[model samples]
Target chain A: MRNHNVTIGIFIVSGLALFTLVLFTIGNEHKAFSPHVDLHTEFANISGLTKGSDVQVAGFDAGEIADIEVPKSPSGRFRLVLRIDQRLNPLVRTDSLVTVDSEGIVGDKFVQIHGGSANAREAAASTTLPSKEPLSLADLLESSNDLINGANGTMKGVQGKLDGTLDAATKTINNANDLIVGIKQGKGTVGMLLRDQTTATEIQQAVANGEQATVSVKQASASLKHASGQADALVSDFASRGLGGKVDQTLLSARGAAGNLDSISGQLHQTMTEALGEDGRGVDAGGNIQQSLSNLTETTGNMAADTEALKHEFFFKGFFKHRGYYSLADLDPTTYRNDRVFTNPDNGRAWLEAARLFEQTSNGQERLTTEGKLQIEEAIAELGDGALNGPLVIEGYSSQSDSGTQLAASHSRALLVLHYIHARYQVDLRNIGAVALRNTPPPGVHKETWDGVCIMALKASS
Target chain B: MIGIFDFVGAVGLFGLRVIGSVFRIPFELEQIWRHIGEAGVRSLALVLSAGLALGVVMTLHTRGALVMFGATAMIPKLQSLGFFVEIGPLVAALLVAGRVGAGNGAVLADMRATEQIDAIEALSMDSFKFLVVPRVVACVIALPLLTVFMDFCGILGGYLSEYTLSHISLHLYLTRAFQGMQWSNFVPPTLKALVFGFIIGTISCFFGYTTNEGAEGVGRAATSSVVVSSLLIILADVILVKIIFLTFPGSAT
Candidate 1:
């Protein structure tokens, strides 16, 4: 062979000699090679511990594990063995905890000690490390399950509310649908509008016309508002003159016109009656009625037949008569129209009211005291007036009575308010008697607790 | 079996016969030193390569089991445990035992077959004193030294795989590897290596020195020496473990 013989003598001797050398060299790593102490501990579970493990102080390696023994379950406690290097004894405290941990995943297990305390004293050699209970996987899963359950409960609550709301909304929508269906089948007023074709057509046409009329009404209202403003301005202008003077002037002119018209119309009427009233009053009495009508028309050609329209229109009847202070007798004595024309058919009176009121203050001809007379006269002399209310009391109570005596005095001091109808600004007195009544209960009701019924007895009006 | 016992007793007696041959060491050392060029130093590469490769295989085998739970990260620790605690020492010890056991047995057996041992006996010199003790002591000493060398190279091999495959920084790997170790991890192996070398050397030398006639005896001696040494190594390991680990397992680190 090219190679020298491979001797077992060379092989075996070389292998052993060098191994012994390195053993004592790396021995410096542990405190045992020098002078050191040892500590021990036991626990219920060692979990897969092996030798050569570390004792950690606050996650830092402080010592090596020195020994392990599975002692006979000492005093009923599970057997465990530990040996901690003594040089690191300063790091262990009485309150320190010891636990077993795997060096790596699925690796050999070792005992890890978490040591230290601010107030705890230094632990002695052979000190037992306290055991700690760690949170288990089961605990984690339970809490996670609880959170999921809570989330599920929240979703269920929201689902229930949504379901109720949807049901109510669906029911409401169904009712609305039924209403629409009823209308299509022609029930009630709404159904009539939808189902009656003639009524619908007429209403449609009316609505069109009404829409047009609405425009005219709006324009009229606008014009009337402007004219009313102008009227107000004119009235304001005339206020200094007092409307009584104009009313007096109008009454005089109407009297003069009536006088002139009465004499001429009377004469004409007599002549017509003697000429045609008797002889041509009937068809047989007349000589050729057509010839007479023609002759009548020829003679009256200078006259207007339109004068008859004046009677129907009340052109001869002044609107002021019913509302006027003067009666027909107060007209100028020499002037008159037909006497019956000024009469009111409803009252069969020639005037709205005929009365005399006289007041005297310290005068023998007086029938009333001035204040009483003024009050009554104001109430009575108003044109077209009637009583609004019989009378009401205005009682004033003094503050002194609250402390002194009876539960307040009731008395009457004045009449109630008079109301009127504004018929186109003509204030016609209308019968009315309504008053807003308020009765204040006495003050100072003491505080009361619930669970009791409190009754109040009402007093009839005295 | 009785004859076998007598034969073993005769061999033990022959090996002790050479204890007085201490004066022959200088020449023997010279020869050993000369052969060191070939056996130990020359074959150092093969030894180192085989040791390193064995370390890698050991590291991977242990790590693969641990990695089911993703403990490959702890391979340096495991490799350290295997090498320093068991594999590193055992592999190197067995290698030396095989390599030295067969060689010693063959040489002695060949010398007997070639009539060289008889010639030494005729020369009025104690053949056992001249030949057996030097080789036995040499093997006892040399095998452990070789094992130590193998251990160092195996550690390096473990580190290479760690650095190459797992990317453990040298600083971190060295630190963790050294962390779980104690004097016991190293001392027990080296001491055991010494015992192992003695067993291998004495048995193989004994087998060959008293070997039956012919080349067949030489072959049988060499083969039997390897087998016997291997079995003795396992038995010594078991006893040593009880002494080291069982006696003081926790503090052994």
Candidate 2:
């Protein structure tokens, strides 16, 4: 029984030994008992990296860290050693970058590798690849400190600028407000200009006063103009009537007494001898007296006869010369004055009336005079209707220059001459408005030096 | 000094018996078959239990180590590499050495103390065939099957480990196991286990059949078998790894 037990024990032990072997052998092909490769990476600061952490390429997990071996150098810096799978070695390129990151905000630290340029070579095994230094706590604190300092300085400057600007702005606003109040209170020039009401009252009073003065001026001007017209007509009419009646009587009487004036001159010579008969020498003295008396009386008689002859020739000879010879040429003044019709070579009728008036009234015609005014009106009307497009002359004369002083005689004469024509006679310039504005420059010469006359030529504006 | 001699004498006697047992094994195979049935079938529960337990324990324990490295998905690799090269041979050899080696030694001690082997020798039938050969042959055959069974159990253990400790499902584990890697990874370990089985069985038989110092001698033989077998297993693993790693590292890879 013991021997049998021994054999049983041996078989059991052998089977058990085989069992143990099976476990290991099965694990072997599966790499459970196989050796694994170890690779490492290092960084200046791991940023809370721990062992057995994942290593990723791009986003995929290519391997893990088997161990973290920190080899201390003489300088007391630890060179980190990480064991990684050999399979993942090729994923690490020459320029691949690694960053320390966490799964989430609080997850474990991992090394994330960024794929490098396509042309780069893969990192080899057992190689210590370069690593980027992660931002340390000191760096963060330093940057934050700089930011705070900058912010503080900016705030200080802003505060100071704001203080100065606010004070100046407030003062300026107060001054503006004071100026506005002053204007409301009617102070200074602009304040009064903007707010004063007394100016309006004064202006209304001045307007009423001006109206009264205008009414008086209107009455005075009307009275003066009426008096001037009637007086001028009466004076001119009487002069014309008296001169005509008296001159006619004298001409008729002289024509009738021509023989008697011849007989009286012989009687006056015989009378001179009778007054000398009182003395024997009376005959010689009387003869001398009579001869002297007779010579004086005879000279006076001859002058009277010559004056009558000149009058007859002037009136009758001009009438006869123009009546007998009418041609389109320049004629003598007396003849031209007698005829109002002068013909030009262009077959146009030139009014001899204009020439006659120019000669007759060369001393400036008093258009306001009342003689033959109807005739003047008819001539003006005819001239207008003809639309001759010819120049008409309007003139003015200033009886006074300066303050009755010849000191500025020439200057005032020119100026006053233009002023009178503009103010009085130059009215109705639509028909005839020309002025030969003149100054008494030389002793015998009155030259119209200024001809600044505006001519209104009518045309349609369309 | 005595201890050294005793060990020397023990190894010497063990060698002689092993040679003698080999010559006698074929004739007594029928009787050995009976022993095999008795020892193997009777100890099936224990063998399977111990084998499976060792396999599972080793797989789970080592798989856990691999897991911390995020290598849990490689549980089958763990199982294969471990079972084939180191796990299958060494574990099986040690267990058999401890169990069968002690059993044989005790049996020989009993025969010696009771004069059973002496009596058999006097009958002119080879006592080596009757006592040593049957036991040796029994162990040699049984240990290998046990190792194979253990290999299976180890794979199962790896699957269970991945299931419990990892997110891997049993189906996936088996799918990965049955992948060509299983048969391929199996060839080396099981082959090695055959050698381990022979080594352990022959050593146990040698130590047991050569018992000399009576009851004490049997105890000594049992202890020696275990020690020698364990040592041989280790030595064999080292040499095998060198040859494999050095010559065909690619294969292991």
Candidate 3:
């Protein structure tokens, strides 16, 4: 009986101890005995934020959701009451922002509170905070689609003009490719200069002959000085002694011969100038005065072909008073070459230097130059506004800048050239296309003849 | 079906009679003390062992599930919630029904079968009040206490199992165990034990007090006591849980 009483006592003692432990632990978790403050906020959508979700203040765990209430009114806003630790009450303020957030993408929802300004009053119990609504994936996707559609429309408009420009570029490239093939086969003047050994030897001989002519000119000037001195001495001797009359007559005849040579050189220059129409008044078989000038320029370029050309090249070009007509082709074989434009056939092509056309050095708006006006007139007449072939392409190139930036700048230059051509010739703008290129030449292009320039090229419609 | 209805009706009356005699028993001090020893002290080993085993098993199961979500730290909280809500009350009631209810029923049934109950009546003592009331009162008092004991033991068992896998401090584990629990969580499930005790006591007494088949009836009474009490306790739990949720809305979370 004593043992039974002891057993009962032990049972009662253990049971009460466990009961107390449970109450204490549970009470602590609930903050039942701790001091706390109540905070409130209203949300249009709770997004499954249930009770016990953590309430954080500036990313720190400050509290937990105590209760959620759906008001009696039909507006359907939910009022959430939170139990926060007393220590965190100072951080909460009347103007603080509250938002519902989640742990990760798919984790539990929680209330996040951002502290108000320093001057804002500390929050009282049950202080209300402004709530922010979270953005859904559907909203993000809809905005993205709107952006994509806008870009697609702009790209479509650009693609049409790009296709036309691309076709002209392809044909021009094919012509240049054929030229390269001919040059490689030693079929043209340029090819002969590169590959024909006899032509090379002849060029060496011509250079030698030019050097000899320079030496002869120097010797003749020395001889003229010597003859003048000798004439002075002989005249003195004739006056003083009246001796050697044959020698005196011979000196006078030599002087007469020098005068005749000078006269003959003058006559030769006058005749050549008249033939070439240096005065811009002579017309060739084409009945175009400028056509005659172009032919003369071409003839001047091939100075190795004729005796008159050699004479003009070696002596007359140096002595000529004309400033503009004295081209560098007279002296250097490579200078002032017209091979960059291999064909004319009515439809003309030319590369106008960007620097010569524009006052401003780099990019942007361009001011016209004196040479630019002359070149534009020539290009417009040559293009014929597609009367001979198809559209005229004013392709702009810049090898020194970024492709996109350079292309855009090149496009601006092309547009300027296009406007000039249109204003002068009343050419249809539709029959002109502008192209921009980077450091690389266009398709099938072997070389770039003009860098930082607008190349006005013509192509047949086919 | 008729016998079942008759049995249910008789048990209902017996429950009422126990309630009726509870206040008027003149505080039979010795009998109450002896019954407390029999019902509570005697049942300690079984309750503690079962509670500990249950706690270990539940912890293992919850760990396996929560681990997939990287929520292994939630083991303690889940164990506490499981014990307080379902495991502690139900297990305590069932254990008592098996040990205390069967013992009371078989003892009373044997006395009735052998005419000892009649002899007590002939001696001018109230057999209903003396034999039935103390046992019913003892059960009503002891079950809740034993449930508390079981809940604590189960938490310890869970901690022991958790410790083997990961060394969580005792203080931290206990704190996490009670992280979301409340007085409401503790109250309803503990109060439900009162209903459980009444069901076990009344059903067992009803069977034992009216024993009819002599020695054979004693065995049937003990068997029926465990079976009927367990079924009624489970049925009552369903209703209790609903009432708990309605009365205390956020306690479930």
TM-score of chain B of each: 0.84, 0.79, 0.96
Over the stretch A147-173, how does candidate 2's per-residue lDDT look in tens digits? 999999999999999999999899889
**Candidate 1's error at A101, in angstroms?**
3.0
After the best TM-score superposition of candidate 3, give how far the Cα of residue B167 lies from its true spot, in angstroms.
2.2
Stretches of candidate 1 exceeding 4 Å from the true structure: A1-21, A24-29, A34-52, A67-91, A122-129, A133-462, B1-43, B60-68, B182-184, B212-253
Off by over 4 Å in 3: A49-69, A101-110, A115-119, A134-462
Task: Encode model 3's per-residue lDDT on A1-462: one tens digit a residue.
Answer: 888888887887877777777777666665657899999999888877877677888887676788999877778789999888888788888899999887654355789988888899999998887888765557778988998999898888889889889987997797687668757866445765667799889999999999999999999999999999999998898878866787789999999999999999999999876776633554543467567889999887676456446446856654432322332112221221222221223334566666777666455456666467667666655556554244565666665556677766666676677666655444566665555554333432445444555444443421
Per-model DockQ against the true two-chain complex: 0.25, 0.05, 0.34
Candidate 2 has an interface RMSD (Å) of 10.9
Worst 10 residues of 2 chain B by lDDT: B178-187
TM-score of chain A of each: 0.30, 0.33, 0.38
| TM-score ranking, high to low | 3, 1, 2
Relative to the true structure, candidate 2 has a C-alpha RMSD (angstroms) of 37.2
Q: What are the lDDT figures for the candidates, one per model? A: 0.58, 0.57, 0.76
User: How many residue pairs of model 2 clash at the backbone?
Assistant: 55
